[model samples]
Structure formats: structure tokens, C-alpha cells
Target: MPNLRDHATLHFIVLIWGFTAILGKLITIPAVELVFYRTLIAAILLGFVLVQRRQPFRLSTGAGLKMLGTGMLISAHWILFFASANVSTVSVCLAGMATATLWTSILDPLINWRRIAPFEVFIGLVIIVGLYVVFRFEFDHAVGLVLALVSAMLAALFTVINGRLIKKHNHTVITFYEMAGACLGCILFFPFYVRYFFPKRGLVLVPDAAIDWVYIGILAMVCTVYAYTVAVKLMTKFSPFAINLTVNLEPVYGILLAFLIFGDAEKMTTGFYIGTLIILLAVLAYPYLNKYFEDTKNAWKDRRAEKRAEKQALEKQNTTNQDPALETIKVNR
Candidate 1:
């Protein structure tokens, strides 16, 4: 089990991740360019760490291509994630991203060709109600919320794909390749991005301000590289259940931090908060609900086994009680 310090460290890492949207808003660069630089720097940092640790850097061509494809999804996810923050308040963006669990619940069964868990579907519907409440009250930020929701869907897709890939490859190596792929994707898309999206400004690769560079650096290095590596290490000590349950709090932490930093700008309607609360409750309850179902199934199995044992024992007792005279006759024969 992880000690208190380990738990604290994990929360600190999550806090850094929570700060990511804030950092995205604080930086003056456009979302696409921001993702490009973030991935580029993070890839370089991770690659250096891999080389220093003498980790293998090569993969089969097929796996490399798969990682590259997945990288595109990651790139899209980050772009929309940051764009949401740019267009609306950080709380709104994070609130939408918080629905990622609901997306995963729907996608995982379909993608993996398994029966959908009914409880998961029930919770997912609850999340939808929450979203409706938010949308009804905060129609002005609809675009941002929609963008963030798309980002969450992309996140769920990539996560499911990564889950499959990690079974056969080193997690760190997979992350490095994915980051490299994301960076390459950003580079390839630059022309289209400039021609269509921002015809007036042209291509702006570097941050205009020095302080923006600082924020980007912290985003790439501390948030992506350091936190990712440390979280992987922590997996050896903590259960995945524990880690994921804690990660569900990222939106909560982010929203609170956004309020703290941006003050009145981060405030939202009562309906918005109610919606957020409902979504978070569903997200947080998932693991416990899953565990409960599993435990109940196991207990049912145990009870059946006990009944079978008792039935056999009683049958044997009945047979022995009637068999003494018959046994003597059979022995004599």
C-alpha cells in the first residue's frame, strides 16, 4: 500500500494537472500552437530521460504507426481542451471534461465487444441530466462546453487505445512515441491551420511574452514529464482503483483553483454548480459501485458452494443411516 507521503505526492501531481487549463488560458498563444509546443517540449524531455535511463527506444513499425495515429487523437483532444478554456471560463471547460467517465462507460463496452454494464448506463444517464441542467442555465458558453465535451470523447478514445497498447509495450516508451506523434501532427497541420483558421495573424509558433514561455515550460516539463513519470512509479505502490478514484477529483480541484485565481470571472450560476455536483457524484461513485457489484457476485458464488457442500453431506448421512443391514448382506455375498 502507498504511504501518506505517496498519497500526498499523487494529489500534488493532480493539482499540477488541474492547473493545466489555467496555464492554457494564461498563455497568449492560440490553442493549436500551444499544444504543438507543449507536446514538442514534453517529447524531448521524456526522450532524454529514456536515453539517460538506457530504456529501449525502438518499436515495431506497426506499433509505431499505431502510436502515431493515436497521437493525432491526443493532439485534437488537447487543442479542444485549451480552446474551450480560451473561449469560456476554466470552470466551464473543466466541468465539461468531467464527463469523460460517462463517455468511457459508453465506449468501453462497445469497443471491447462486451455487454454494457447496466449500472454504468444508469450513472451515465444521470450525468446527462446534470449536463442538461448546466446547458439550460449557461447557454452563453455552449460552444466552449461542446468543445470540451468533444475533447473528453477524444480523451476516452485515446485512453482505451492506450490501454490496449500498454499490454505489449513499455508505458514510458509508448508515451514518448505518442508525444512525438502529436508533435509531428501539429507540424503537419500548421499549413491548413494558418490558411483557414487564422488567415489574418498567420502562423505564430513562439509565445509573444517571456512569462508565457515560463507557463508553457512548466506545463510541458513539470505537468507532463515529471508528473507522468512519477505517477507511473507510484503505480507500483498504489492500486489502480485508488489512483483513478483520486483522479476523478481533478475537475473539482480545477474549478476551485480557477475561482481562487480568477475570482469573480470564474463564478457560475447556481444551476451550473448543481450540474457540476451531480456529474462529480456520478464520477466518484463509479469505482465504489463497481466494487460493490463484484463483491456481491463473489458472495453469491460462495453461498452456492456452501449449499452444494451441505447437500452432499446430508445425502451421505442419509445413505449411511439406512445401509448397515444391506452392507452386511453385500459383504457376505
Candidate 2:
């Protein structure tokens, strides 16, 4: 098990991840352009790390291609993520993203040929009800919430794909290609972006503000690359269950940070907070529920086994207690 320092470090890394949305809001570039640069810079830095470590820069062609394809999903997820924040309050964006784990829970069983846990389905419904309450109160931020929900879905899918790919490929190499792929996706998207989304100025190819560069650099190097590397390293000392439980706190951290940083701008309706709280509670409750059911099931099995042993023992006692004359008669026959 991880000691106090390891756990603290894990939380710190998660805190950094939570700050990502804030960074997105701080950067002045459009979401599409922002993702382009974030991916590009992260890719370059990851590449440099690989070189410094003297890691082989090779993979089976098919795996490399798969990573690249998954990278496109990563790009889309981030574009939508930042766009959601840019368009509406961070509260709405994070509230939607709060369901990503539920999405993963659902997707994992379906993809891996396992039964969907009943608890997952119940938690999903609870989350939906929470979302409904939020949408009812914060109706104006509906578009942003919807965008964030879609982003969460994509995030879930990318995670599931990565789960498999990581078993075969080095995580850094996978990330490097995915980042490159994400950048390539942005480049490919520029034409359509110019045609439909940003007809006026096309792509905002460069950051106009110097502060934007600083934020982008922090986003790429610190948040994207460094946080991921550290998290992966921490995995050696922590269980997946522990890691996931802690990660569920990301939305909480992000929302609170947003409120502290943005003050009144980040405030939402009371109902919104209630809804978000409900969703969070359900998400956090899952592991405990799973353990509870598993333990109960084991208990029942143990009780049944004891009862079975007692019954067999009683039957043996009855057989051994047979009269001696009857036993002798049977033996003579």
C-alpha cells in the first residue's frame, strides 16, 4: 500500500488535473486552436522525454495506427471540454464530466464481455436524475452541459480503448502518438473549421497574447505530460480501485477551484449544487456498494456450506448408530 506521502502526491496530481479547465478558461484562444497547440506541444515534449530515456520509438504498425486513431478522439474530447467551459460556467461543464466514470463502467462490461453490474445501472439512473435537476435549474447552460456530456462519452471511449492498447504499447509512446494524432486531427479539421465554424478569421494560428503562451505551456508540459507521467508512476504503489475513487473527486476540486478563482462568475443555482452533490455521492458510493454486495454474497455462501456439512454429519451419525444385530444380519447375508 502507498504511504502518506504517496497518497498526498496522488491527490496533488489530481489537483493539477482539476486545474486544467481553469487553464482552458484562462487561455484566450478558441477551443479548436487551443487543443491544437496543447496537443502539439505535449507531443513534442513527450517525444523529447522518450529520446532522453532512450526508449525505442517503434511499435507494431497496426498498434501505432490504433493509437493515432484514438488520439483523434482525445482531441475531440478536449475541444469539446474547453468549448464547454468557454461557452458556459465551469460548474456546468464539470457537472457533465462528473458522469465519465459511469460511462466507463457501462462501456467496460459491454466491451469486455462481462455482465454489467447492477450497481452501475442504479448509479447511472441516480446520475441522470441529478443531471435532470441541474438542467431544470440551470437551463440556460444546457448547450454547454450537453457538449460536456458528449465530451465525457468520448472520454470514456478513449479510456476503454487506451486500457487495451496500454497493455501492448508503452504508455508514453502511446500518448506521444495520440498527441500527434490529436494535432493532426486539428490540422485536418482546419479546413472545415474555416468553412463553417470560423468563416471570418479561419484558424487563430498563433496566440496574440503573451499570457496565452504561458498558460498553454503550463497546460501542455505540466498538466498534460507531467501529471500523466506521475500518475502512471503512482499506479505502481496504489490499487486501481483507490486511484478511481480518488479521481472521482476531480469535479469537486474543479468546481470549488472555479468558485474560488472566478468568484461570483462561477456561482450557480442552489439546485445546481444539490444536483451536482447527488451525482458525486452516487459516483463515490459505487466502490463501497460493490464491496458490500460481494461480502454479503460470500457470507451467504459460507453459511450454506456450514449447514451442508452439518447435515452430512447428522446422516453419518445415524448410519453409524445402527443396531449391532441388524449390522450382523446384513453382514451374514
Candidate 3:
């Protein structure tokens, strides 16, 4: 179990993650531009932190390329995440994102060579039903919902990839490379996003208001950089499931914060609330199920170890008796 301070820090990081939606809404820039700024700022900040910590800032060629690829996926996820918020209400965006666990269940076995759990599949199907309810009611926001689902899949993919990388490297180093890749992806996509996605549709990248800078700063600094760093650090102490389960609260925190900040604009129909409730319930249920299975696995391992130790003790006693007889034979000879 994590210490109290760790628990506090974990919640704080999740809170920042939850607030990202509000910041996305408050910022005036387009999702592509905003994500571009976010990745650039995060990469810069992580670079400085890596230097300060005196960790090796370089990686092997293959590893470096892999990290960058992972970062690009993350960049895509963030872009879609923010775009979802822009096209739909924050509540709907977050509710859609709550399917990340379901994505993980389907992805982990395929990625990590593990057997799929039937219960996980059943629960995941339940979550899909919840999503179907939301989609049926919010059919007008179909594009945004699809974007959010894609984002969740991307998020799950990189998350599983990161779990393997974190074992061999420091969290900061891993983050720096990923952030660098995200920056590169944003820059590469900038011209295309502007020319094709924006102007072709007659949308603007630059917001008219000066106050947008403050929101961008909060989104980049507090939410992206700080929250991501803290979460990475926490992974050293917590299991991936534990960390993700905690992060699952992002929607709840975001939904409440959206209501508090945006008030009447954030309110939804009774069906929407019911669907959100079902999704959140799944998020809350994951930790308990994970804990139960983990504990069961540990207990089984302990029993096996005890039996092995007992067998070793009996073998040693037999060896000791045989040694005395062998000594007697040597003396008689």
C-alpha cells in the first residue's frame, strides 16, 4: 500500500488531470494548437528536470525511436481528448473517456501475452452498454464520441507500453523522451491540421482574447507537465492497475468541477446522469476486483513456497543421515 503522502499526491495529480477539461474549454486556441503548446512546454520542462536530476538524457537508438513513437500516440490521444471536450460538453467527453479501463482489458492480454479474464470481459461489456446509452441519447455528438473512444484506445496502448519501459529506466527519462516525441508530432502535424482541418472548415487557430494565455499556462504547466510527472513517479510505488483505477476518478472530479465552474451550461438530462453514474460505478469497482485477485494470487504463491521449504528440510535430513553411514564405512575400510 502507498503511504498517506503518496495517496494525497496521487489524488492531487488526478485532480489536475480532471481539471484539464476545464482548462481546454477556457483556452481560446484550437485543439491542435493547444496540444502543440502543451507538448512543447512539457518537453521543455521535462528536459530541465532531467538535467537537474543528473539522469542520462540519452537513450539507445531503438529505445529512443520507440519512446518517440509512444509519445506521438500520446500526442494523438491528447489532441482527440481536447477536441472531444470542444465538440461536446465536458461531461460527455469525460464519460466517453471512462471506457479506458475497458480498452486496457482488451489490450493488455494482446500486448503482454496474458490470458484474458472472463469477468473483466463481462464488466467491459457492461461499460459498453453504458456507453451505448450515452451515444443513443447524444447522437448529435457522434464525431466527438468517436474521437474520445479513439483517445481512450491510444491512452491504453501507451500506458501498457510505458509499464514495460518504466522497469528499465527512470520515470523522468521515460517522460522526457515521450514528451520530445509528442512535441515532434505536434510540429509535424501543425501545417496539416491548420490547412486541412481548420481553414478548410473555416475555423481559426488564434483566439482573439489575451486572457487565453493564462488558461494555456495552467493547462501546460499544472495539468500536463506537473500532473504527468507526479503520476509517473507514483508508478514506482503503485501497481499500474492501482494507478489507473485512481485516475479513473478524473471524470468524476472533472464532471463536478465542470458543474461548479460552468454551472447551468454543464448540466445534462436525467439519462445522461444515469449513464455517467453507471460508468463511474465501473471505475470505482475495478480496484476492488483487482485487489481481490492480487491477494488470491499472493496467497497461493505463499502456500507453494511453504511446501517447497518443507520438502527441502526433509531432503537435508536424509542427506545428513547418509553422510554419517558413509563415514562409518570409510572407518571400517
lDDT by residue (tens digit), candidate 3, 213-241: 77887887898777877777798899877
- Top candidate by lDDT: 1
Candidate 3 local Cα displacement, residue 253, angstroms: 0.4
What TM-score does prediction 2 earn? 0.88
Best by TM-score: 1
Per-residue lDDT over 128-164 for candidate 2, one digit per residue giving the tens place of the 0 to 100 score: 9999999999999999999999999999999999999
Q: What is residue 6's positional error in candidate 3, in angstroms?
A: 4.8
lDDT of candidate 1 over 1-333, digit per residue (tens): 788999999999889889999999899999999999999999999899899999997989999999988988999999999999999999999999999999898888878887877899899999999999999999999999999999999999999999899999999899999999999999999999989988999878777898999999999999899999999999999888899999999999999999999999999999999999999999999989988887898999999999999999999999998899789899999
Clash totals for all candidate models: 0, 0, 0
Candidate 3: stretches off by over 4 Å: 1-6, 200-205, 232-242, 304-333
Q: Over 4 Å off in model 1, which ranges?
A: 301-333
lDDT measured at residue 312 in model 1 versus the true structure, 0 to 100: 100
